[model samples]
Target: MKEYKPSFLFRNAHVNTCFPTFFRKVEIEYRRQRVLLRKDDFLDFDWVEKGNSKIIVLCHGLEGSSQSHYIKAFSRYFSERSWDVLALNYRSCSKEPNPSPFFYVAGKGDEIATALKLTSEYQEVVLIGFSLGANKVLDYLGKEEKIPKNVKMGVAVSPPCDLKESSLLFSKGWNRIYEQYFLKQLKRKVIEKEKKYPNILKEIGISIEKVQKATSLVEFDHLVTSQLAGCSDAYDYYEKNSSLFHLRKIHHPTLILTALDDPMMSEHCYPREEVKNNVWLHLETPQYGGHISYASFEKEYWLEKFVFETVNQFQNRK
Candidate 1:
């Protein structure tokens, strides 16, 4: 049931990954809500609620804000259908920096849960996450022992569920291009945070210079992410936090969409056996959907349409 129809030219993995990012234009008005987390940090959530009983929460990829093309596309489609949609921006993903020195880099559900708290308790909820956001969705669902009764389903696209293995894969070959770009972006954030909270990294036993000097994803994680997450190092952070380990614990009717050719994905993240054993977890590999990129000629996209249908199916049963 998880099928995707793609445009021919976007069939190539690289093309699928890059085309929408550069060319696609989607604009939608949002009523922005700045939420204060318990830790004193604030997150920006963009809302398009149309007084609907059902709502979809959209989580974007690494360094992606609520303005990401895929997120905007999803918001527009769902909102037009009379389904409320809220896109939550991660700390520092918004216009302002969070008061906390650290940003959530791994698949921790803390921030996602915080955002969900803003929603009406009586409304049915669907959570959709892409790439790094996908990992967070899966982790949040699996790790939380007490899922809200109103939260019905979840969707994860291009999730690098196995963080350690995927980070290693991200360091090699053409993947390095993305790796470099992301590193540049993340470094800029670290600099911003450092300027706002001087010696913040030092207090945590890491230097801003060291974080800026890191070349690979693993090194950067080792310096910052691991420390922030309270792990020994990057490997430990990945080992403990990767959503792959938490899939079996998920209770909701969840869907995972991963491209077979996705650059950083490995077998650890896409285990057939795990999905087979869990009726709640549905896995769909579309041969080449290319890391959250689905090229489409139609105004109604394959990714969004399929997810809506899937969610509809689940909601009907409820």
Candidate 2:
């Protein structure tokens, strides 16, 4: 792994965490495309063309879209490097609401497979997923016996490998702040879904009142996410979906990036033992970098530069 030296002025974890959201500026022009899925559902993709055969597919974190700062930053970085970029937005995550009421979850690898099929024309492809999307990528690679020949490698940043553990952490102090933010967005989406598919919430045994009363992510997941996704409950959902157990089965060359100080994940989220045993997996846990944010005053966003360089190294070695 390349050495990471964070700027001294903003080395504090929280400072590095919050700096980019307020200071970083990313503007990338993209041509939007909607991908139709098998179940009559659709995913929105933002394409930044560089007229190159090599392509990179970016999967954003929970509640994130193509306009996310990290997505835009990487899109611009790879586009400048002459690589085609496709930023996948999960169902209902784009400008238009999805027709189906069911949305994406952390371990929904099938959706990633659907996205990969759409990129068959590219000679080379790399999957880069952040947070929740990262878990989806790892799950997909592990479960599939064979991956697309064009997909060379994958990079997952700050993934919640163990969904149950991460959920427990989110219900506690400080972490509750993050939980509340996510819950607000999720609730809004659920309400929107209710408007289009009125029977969805009823079918899942979740009422609009119960959803409005949700105070934590755990409660929300149990009441809505788990039911809508066909799990018995939140625990069952986490048990079936968490990527930690699937890590050992991955055959593709993959890099996992996380930080010891990441507020969103518990220590269990880092699969150090699994990575040590798996030849295909590479793990890097820096001393700092909160969640997906790895900002430095000098570089503004260190994660973007690190990912670009690491991916390039992987490409050259391949």
Candidate 3:
């Protein structure tokens, strides 16, 4: 693993974390496809094809889509290198309201499995996920008894592997900003769902008013996510969905990237002990790189460059 040195321009965690949202601008042309799942739930995937045999699937974070800065940057980086890139958007995240009230959660591994099945045409497939999507990817890879032959490797960036601890940390000082930002978007989605499908809230036994009152991610999960996802409560959802406990089950080579000072994650999120015991798992903890942001003044973005370099090394080893 390469060492990640923070740039002098943005040494602070918050600055490196929040700088990409404003400073980074990347645009890539994609061919969109709507994948229909077994349960009839649909997910949208934005594909950038370079007529290559190797394909990379990119999963965005909570409330994020294919247009997210990190996804766009990574997609553009790999696409330029002639690797086919697919940015998979979770339900209701494509700026289009999904028919089902149940949205994507951290532990929804089946969705990722279905996505890989859909894109099984590629000879080589690499899974790359950020934040919540990272958790989902890790959970899926770990829990599955048999991984797809096309899946050569995986990379999870800034994943909250321990969901419960991370959720608690979100309500703490400075982290509340991210919690509020996510809650606002979640509440808006619920409201939109109610407007489009009037029976959705009724079916879930949750009201828009109750969802609006949720100021924290835990409250939102308890009231809305848990009920819709068939979990008894927020704790159950977190316990069942968190990837930390399942890391030992993973069979394929996987890289887990995280920062020590990520505002959205707690120290427990790193799972150092689990990674140490698991030969298949490689953990990279840089002192900097806030959340999904690893920006440097010298490059397009440090994270993207690092990811490309790491994946290239993995390919070379293979």
Local accuracy of candidate 1 as per-residue lDDT tens digits, 9-121: 87788888887788888889999998776576778899997889889999999999999989999999889888998898998899677778778766864777876787756
- Candidate 3, clashing residue pairs? none
Q: How close is candidate 2 to the true structure, as a TM-score?
A: 0.95
Q: Per-residue alpha-carbon lDDT of model 2 for 136-202, expressed as tens digits?
A: 8888888787689999888999999999999999988777777888999999988888887777667
Error of 3 at 169 (Å): 0.6
Candidate 3 per-residue lDDT, tens place, 1-318, comes to: 666787676678889888888887888899999887646478888989878998899989999999999999988889888799988888889988888777888885566787788678899899999999999889988888777899999899999999999999989999888889999999999899889888777775887788888889999999988887789999999999999989998888899999887888888888899988989899998888889998776547778888889888888998
Give model 1's TM-score versus the native structure: 0.95
lDDT score, residue 14, model 2? 66
- Candidate numbers, best TM-score first, in rank order: 3, 1, 2
Candidate 2 pairs with clashing backbones: none
Model 2 misplaced stretches (Cα beyond 4 Å): 38-40, 298-300
lDDT score, residue 159, model 1? Answer: 89
List the candidates' TM-scores in order. 0.95, 0.95, 0.96
